[model samples]
Target: MDTTDDARTRIDTTVAHPARRYNYWLGGKDHFAADRASGDAIAAAMPGVKLMAVENRAFMGRAVRYLAEQGIRQFLDIGTGIPAPNNTHEIAQSVDPSSRVVYVDNDPIVLTHARALLTSAPGGANAYIDGDLRDPEAILAHPDLPATLDLSRPVALLLVAVLHFIREDEHPERIIETLTAALAPGSYLVASHATWEYLPAEVIAALTRNNTDGRFQARTAARFAELLAPFDLVEPGIESVAYWHADDVPGPRPSAEEVACFGAVARIR
Candidate 1:
């Protein structure tokens, strides 16, 4: 549990942040007034925004469970937001008590909440790396990462709902390659990103503007495919967060209206 305590007071409550806003949308108590304001504005524009958050979390749990059941003992979850129930470590360790997880986030508030998310099983471990997704090397080289994870073994790397925050100009491919290539062949890469392919023109414009704080980068279908190219995609390929690995549990799925996210799970060679 390498949580950074030097950042609690440094967090600004002025501009909204993706992680804090997301926490607000998910009904978490760690968000600020600015986050709530931003989240409410986005929700007003897209009524399904909260639904997307919930579904994305469900997808995370399913993906972690799937990987753990496949015997993945280590996990690297980048862009981890405020502490929430059914976190990566919880889901994975429930399947196998020896599972170890390291969560990474750049948000200072998220770092403040890191300790709450670090509860681990007796035989397992959970740690947090206060770093950015753009700097995968720093995360990989962090002291707590290697202390809890075995790079030579299969690891499930989760980038769920966070890549959208990284603009395309950042060369997301190189980052993915660097992280995925460092893992064992049986390792898995699971991510969910926002896409314009599911939204209408007007809605896209408004949503894009809402994210104009230089935080998220909405991508297209083609670009999404390129990110998953480094690994062999699992069944059903990349699809809507609600459609990927969807179980037969209920009513009609979210309409094709304006989905800005797609999810996929792939394995390294």
Candidate 2:
């Protein structure tokens, strides 16, 4: 973890951040007034948005456990928001203590909480890289990445609840291609993306504004699946987050409408 004063300075408390807002929605107290205002606005516009956040995270836990069941031990988790329960490494290492993971995120506040996310089991290696998804090459070439993961082995790339922040012009598919091309055939890609399928156009428009920086573009289910076209989709492909792997889900399940995110896991073949 960098934890440098300069890096911490980049966080703008005045403006709402998706990561912090997400934390706020998850009932965490790490957010400021701006984040609360923004989160409350979005939740008010579309009811149960906080449920979406919870379901999206549950999707991550299911997907990570699925990868571990498939015997994949290396993970490169990007867009990792503020540290939360059932983190990628925690889920993966629980299945196999030797599982190795490297988390990447450009959010300075997330990096500040990196220490909590970096714990590993006796036989595992866990590290964090302060990087962004827009730059696949930089994430691929991160020095700590190779040290934590073996490129030759099957690794699961986790991209949960993050791609919606990347606009279409940014070439999100190409970013996936670049990252996937660097992995071996059996490597897996697990992703969950926000969608406008169930929402009316009016609600979509309102959410668009509440989101900071005019970002947060929700895609259709087919368009979301297109992001993983290069790989072979696993069972229950591209379903709503809450239903992706329902049996693996813990506690009472959130309804489909409560989760507007499309979730899937695929293998490079």
Give the winner by lDDT: 2
Best by TM-score: 2
lDDT of 2 by residue, 1-269 (tens): 53656568898898888899999999998899999999999998888788899889988998898889989999999999899888899999999999999999888888888788887889999999999999999999989999899999888998888899889999998999999999988999999898777888899888877765758888998898788887899998888888887885567877777778889999887
lDDT of 1 by residue, 45-144 (tens): 7878888888788788888888888888899999999888899999988999889999999899887777777889989999988889899888888899
Q: What is the lDDT of candidate 1?
A: 0.84
lDDT scores of the candidates, listed in order = 0.84, 0.88
For each of the candidates, the C-alpha root-mean-square deviation to the true structure, in angstroms, is: 1.8, 1.6
- Which run of 10 residues does model 2 get worst, by summed lDDT? 1-10
Candidate 1's C-alpha runs over 4 A off are: 1-4, 256-259
Model 1 scores a TM of: 0.94
Model 2, residue 231: what's the lDDT?
Answer: 88
TM-score of each: 0.94, 0.95
Candidate 1 local Cα displacement, residue 202, angstroms: 1.6
Report how far off residue 222 is in candidate 2 (Å).
1.2
Worst 10 residues of 1 by lDDT: 1-10
